[model samples]
Target: MRKNSMKNMRINEEVHRELSNIIRSEIKDPRINPMTSVVAVEVAPDLKSAKAYISVLGDEKSQKDTLAGLTSAEGYIRRELAKSVNLRNTPQIRFIMDQSIEYGVNMSKMIDDVCEQDESKAKSREE
Candidate 1:
């Protein structure tokens, strides 16, 4: 199947949803922060492997610990995914830390700060 085929896209979405559910509810690892979320999932066209982009809402240490925990639980997660989604081959999940959400939040805050500064300067000039 082609990489961007409809079937492949469906598979990717299904896997992404299931992975999010599994991570949010199934895993019991202490190191994983409660605020952790699956940002996105990319399954290979051949279904041989997948990349799960994880986002943790916490400090750097928490994020690192969460990734380590997920890495160690890869086998279990794969097994769960297999049971939840019927597929010929359950893709090997590679946990990747996604920083896009955090980056966007920081950018938004910076923009707000700049806007506030500009408004304050305008008010001062008006005075």
Candidate 2:
């Protein structure tokens, strides 16, 4: 079974939401940023392990610290997942830093700048 199918996507979304809530409400690590979000979740077909991609709305230090804190609390996170979700086997949680959102934001800013420059050039040419 391919990992990108609708079923997998649904599972990923559910896991993402569950993990995000668990991290925010249950995990008491000070390193975690208040604005952290679980961007995506990738789970193995056998459900043995899961990689949780998290995005932190802060500087690099905050992102790194959040990842470190999540890594340290992996065991507890998995335990909580097992207790919350009715899965046959709870996957081991691995936290990874996700920069896709930041990249998208930067890309959008660049596009806007280019559009403004083009508009200015066109106006100059017309004048």
Candidate 3:
């Protein structure tokens, strides 16, 4: 059997926490929704770049606007990170919208509708 070696998950978790704090407190962009959360962070082995998955609790337009705001404020975010974390090079931050939450909500609704239909059919059969 072969074992797979991977980058440190703790590093990724630390980065996610620090980035989330920087965005919420340091970044003064009003376009960003307060409800925005950092869902996950993936850092390359070389640590040159990081992709941040964000979940926004709002409509599609708000999510799009929030992403745009984050993209434009990337430089400021990176600078703030330098003061907090010591690294040879600050990884570039990329914001991506996470739709799993929305997908799960839709799937739950579909399942509820199917259950209601089954109950209605059962009642009619009894009548």
**Can you write out model 2's per-residue Cα lDDT over 1-127, one digit (the tens) per residue?**
5788887777677778889889999999999899999988998776788999899999999999999999999989988888877776788888888899999999999999999999999999999
Encode model 1's per-residue lDDT on 1-127: one tens digit a residue: 8989999999999999999899989999999999999988889988999999999999999999999999999999999999999999999999999999999999999999999999999999999
| Residue pairs that clash (backbone atoms under 3 angstroms), model 2 | none
Question: After TM-score superposition, what is the CA distance of residue 121 in candidate 3 from its true location, in Å?
Answer: 2.2
TM per candidate comes to: 0.98, 0.86, 0.86
Number of the predicted model whose TM-score against the real structure is largest = 1
| Candidate that would win on lDDT | 1
Off by over 4 Å in 2: 1-10
Report residue 100 deviation for candidate 2 (angstroms): 0.8
Cα lDDT over the full model 3: 0.85
For model 2, how many clashes?
Answer: 0
Query: Could you tell which candidate, 1 or 3, scores higher by lDDT?
Result: 1
* Pairs in clash, predicted candidate 1: none
Tens digit per residue, CA lDDT, model 3, 1-127? 1111243465577789999998788778899999999999887656688889998989999999999999999998888877787766778988899988888998999999999999999999999
